[model samples]
Target: MPPSADPTVSVTLAEIARIAGVGRAAVSNWRRRHDSFPAPVGGTDTSPQFALSQVEEWLRRQGKLDEVGSRERLWPEFEALGDRDAMGRAIAVAGARLARLTDKEAGPDDSAGWLPGGTDLSDAQRSLVERAVGLAKKHGARDTFDFLLGRWLDTHVRQINVTPSPLAALMAEVAELSRGGEAGDVGTVLDPACGTGGLLLAAARQWAGTADVPASGAPLRLLGQDVDATQAALAAVRLLLAGRSPERESAWGVDVRAGNTLRADPHPDVRADVVLCNPPFNERDWGYEELATDARWTYGLPPRTEPELAWTQHALSRLAPGGTAVLLLPPGVASRRAGRRVRAGLLRSGVLRAVVALPPGSAPPHSVALHLWVLRAPAEGGTDAGAGVLLVDAADVQQEPSGGTQRAGRAAIDWPLLHRRVVSAVQELRTIQTTQTGQAPQTAQTTPAAPAGNADGDRPADHAVVPVIDLLDEEVDLTPARHVPKKATSANLGLRRSWNRFGTLLHELRDLTATLSALELSGEEPAGQGTVTVGDLLRAGALTMRAGQQPADGVVRTGDAPDDAVRVLTVADVLAGGRSSGWLTAPDASAGENAGGLTLTAPGEVVVVGAHRAFGAWVETDAPTVLGSQLYALRADPALLDPWFLAGCLRAPANARQAGTHASTSSRIDVRRLQVLRLPLDEQRRYGEAFRRLTAFERSLREAGTIGGKLVDGLTDGIAAGRLPGNRP
Candidate 1:
């Protein structure tokens, strides 16, 4: 008799395939070929379930177990625990055990018996607690718990809420920067809506070993409040693991309360030295009616849709004099009409300092890029504030490729570069502050160098110092792009470079046009060809279409690979003329694993964007890359179809229109329904060649236009600055 399957913890065949790092077809083949394969533990015929432990044993015997990580192995067990509330409770309990162990207040033999509330734990829950303890021992309590929480959030991302680590790091760094040169002077940090305590943990870590924070002295006071009791408990456990003693009384001030921060203020009168937060965005009913009369709204009352502005006010209200608060907010908050009045108020009072635009995929709800607002609590009589507001556009700062497999749609931040840029901008603001206060320059070059009689002077790349008076308008748009100064083109070398580039582009454009004309004149028009749907070609084995959604692990927005990771080709990359720019990284074997539902791109394959604004390109590069979200990879049989010809037909305007007819409200195209012109192989070769030339022509035209625009701007600036001779025939 074969081994019995464990009914408690089972996974579908698709999950098994994902675990084994193989295709679904391969898993199906394995089931049919191996008699020793795990039998169906549950589910219907179409979706058979196998015991997770049995599948692991089988995969281990076949040497495929190495593909699965410990986190991946634990996920099935976590899911088997049932619902979100149960999962949250189990996690909170496990966190309590880890916290006690970390604080040395519990013995090695201790269990969840010491957990607060004295909730009864089941056998399964106990097992989970033991596993959590093991993980904490191996990976440290903070990292282990953070990983668990991240995975839990990923499993039910729509329902379970938490801040991404990168964004949290950014907010923390901004808080530290807001402290000016005396960053070590910060003794207290607070997060009002501290979900999973990510922002608070980041703040604590930032101030851990500074000179001001003596090792023998009391720990820095960390305060947080959350609506969810379990999340608040988890936050407390996380803070305790970060060196705060459990026995430390409220007199020392380490509070992590479980309550609504908006309605009920835990530390209403206590002002923190630094407040770092990624507050909940786009909440409709955030107690607007009750909080309308609240004193926290020093700025104008935030409208119903602008709950983020209310959180902003709350953070500012909790800040000590001259203390800075960094908040991550949706970009819409910066320019929304409803929040315009509040924005103007913040600007006028010098409470709003800097707004940094981060790249997309920096945090969850990853579709749009978010903004970081650095605000400082104004001093008495507003004497310490600077006259100029600093705006840093570090949006383009990302990791560059370090020779590895790059994944598509993953936004990997270059932390070192970003840190330097943001810090430099803050230093500039500090310089402005010093200058405004009539203080002597500490350094000979303390003042920003400016051209004679030019208020819009030469500034650091991606940095702008906009006057506060200029920001007060009806729109009150605080977007960095609106304020940052353009690059100076007054130098002779700059003008010469622009001219050279324009000339080169013009030459290339002429050559491309000639080549296109020659190709068009040489090729004879073949007899009118019949049209065929892509579905017909797929059914006839002429092509195989594989469409993949964005991976669930995380979206990579940067185009740089760390080491052995593969570079991903995103839809943005495809639309940008199929260049390898803006590529993101994934592990080398991740393409094979398809762990995040990522599909690998192969040479000779034609890739198509299946979403709005349809586009297709042939995979000309041999470099390893994956098909990004809303993209389809079509591998054609060379004997039956030409790769270039297939790509050209798919990208043709006629076929695009046909595909658009089948599009849904979101304008997502079904590539299989696209109509393509069918012709003989010989005739297709001619048309394919012409299409290739046409692509080159279009690229050349774009290059020429870009160069021409730059040339005009350079000339205009040079003439205005009196650097270049303006006389012309």
Candidate 2:
């Protein structure tokens, strides 16, 4: 086996086969047969290393994880909490001695508690590890807890089983990369809803086994308190593994199952430098009635319908001034009016910074696009740097159709690309802050945005801060789209009349150009110059590419491929820029070739990128091609026109601005905005020559960006649109 010392960001297939005890060929066969097997993530030579998130998902699908011990199996001597209420029973059963169970030695009877049937964890602190796994399912949130507990028990428990070393290392490197207060400085890292030890471990690893933040006096402070003792114990195991021994590192604490994040108090006096969490979404009740007089609900009583608002407030409460948090939230949080008060409250409170969309299906079974709401507390004596929220809709990833349907059933989350986007967005946010506000980042300005007109026919108000307290007075629609103001767009972008006229004119122009090209090719004088549509270019041997087609059952990507990535070639990746930027891998070879054919992209080929907004734009490249189907890959006849020139013309201003904007689907993109007109050949060559280096530089910039492994586009968007992917938004 290869050593785990290499610091690359991806996993390999060979390692996957080894872990599953299947040959690489068998792995391939499995991928082909099982529609749900995750595709190859950041590839490694010896073993395929998947994003740790996806790895757990794979195990779940295979039913390989050990279910928690049955009540009878939990302990032979203890009585089952049969008639008692779940929460009350959980508290009674989990109290006191559960912490000491970590010391129990692994044995034949105890072995059953550790692994799934025969699959025990001698590698991990088996007894303790197994308890954490079941504790989450019994006491914590479902999906998130499953991943956290599963990974801790099955993967990271023992030194030998503690694999996927790349993710932990990469996370540390990423945190180091985001260094603001000098290296090795440690304050406290807080996770409000600490279900299992995963995030804390990630944070502990990031802090490099020590806490030494610049301003803080205490060096090693990692504070986390969860509502479940099993979770706390699980976190304890991880903290210990990362060198936070029980007796030695008592300065910081991890409390599990102490109290509700909303109602109870655990670590009420502590403040954190960084707060990271994936809080539960859209809960109907969070005990606002009991906490009616509580301090955390500062603005107003949280609506009985809004758990999201409560979580947001709780996160803000724990956040120290100038501290930053990356909160994973439901998409509706951005557009819902029911949560409007919280939305406006957060925006005006100098806490909200950036809202980014992740790819579809990043969360399994749920296809809504998830958003990362990056927030920060106001800094002392600094100007609030807040202005417009950085609204980035990057949910445009190449997705295979999930059958002509949107549901993925029981597939793993698309964590790789979503992770990449998180890394990219975080890097972008930090870079922007560091560059715009200097190393000592300024406190962003806080001002309530204008109140949105009520969807229920409430009188419209002029621009002003709408009190968060009053948001629940009406039908709650907390969606940002419902109230978040849209920058006025030209009629050309969203209006219908403009679309019709543009379409008619474009068709006439294309047909005319085609006629003129045929006449000129026949040596008959027709129009000003002989012209060929991208479609015509493909017929000639000099140019070739494919178009997109619908996906098979249980896939979540769209686009073409350059035969080698072994996908059905499609036109979706083809932009007006004439370059197929992304390619979709076939979930299985039997799905058939896309665009009705297979084609190869040898180096020096030209490709046209087509999307809902940008239609006629072009690009040329020697980059690897899995020719994405939305695009038209063009291999030009170099004798007549240079390949670079054609690709450059697609981006020319004089050309159509909206290329390939015909798509009506929300998950699949509308490329009309990128379309450009066909410029003169000489002009194309001149522009191409001038901008080639610039394009190369842009490509280099994206290439150099880090990967967080979470899919932001389809994964984030699919889940957020309030329906499964393929469902209309």
Best by lDDT: 1
Q: What is the C-alpha lDDT profile of model 1 across 1-729, one tens digit per residue?
A: 222223579986666876777766678788889999989888755446789988988988888767324545665777788887567667767776776655463444345443333435677766776677766666666566777776676556556456766567767776776667464587889998887788887776677553223443555788888877667767776666555333432212357877778888877887988988888888887998888898888889989889999999999999988888998889999899999999988887778888888765566655566788999997766644465577777666665533222234333666656666566667676666666655432211223444476432133326676777777887889888777644443244455755766677677778877777664353654466578888999999998988755544444433323455555656766666554443343432353333335577778788877766645655445545666677888898888887778788888766666677444566767788876678878777777887777767676677667657867876777667555555654
- Residue 562 in candidate 1 has what lDDT? 46
Shift of residue 496 alpha carbon in model 2, Å:
25
The TM-scores, one per candidate, come to 0.72, 0.41
lDDT of 2 by residue, 1-729 (tens): 111211222334433444454455665577669878775565332234454335445755697433443221222111122211222222222322233333332234332232111222232133333453455344432232333334334322221112123333333344443435644454777777765555566666566445222222344466666655445545553453344323443324443334566777577877777766666666567686787777886545567777766777777678677676666677877666566666666655656666656545443113566665666667767535443344444454323323111221222233344345445534554555556643433322122232375221121111112223333344433333333332222111223333444454455545545544454234564466454555445555645554434443333232212233432234443222223223334322222331123343456765544443434433533344344445555566666566676666555544443333334652233332333235565776765665565455443333223111122332344356444546664
Model 2 segments more than 4 A misplaced? 1-180, 183-185, 209-219, 244-257, 381-387, 398-729
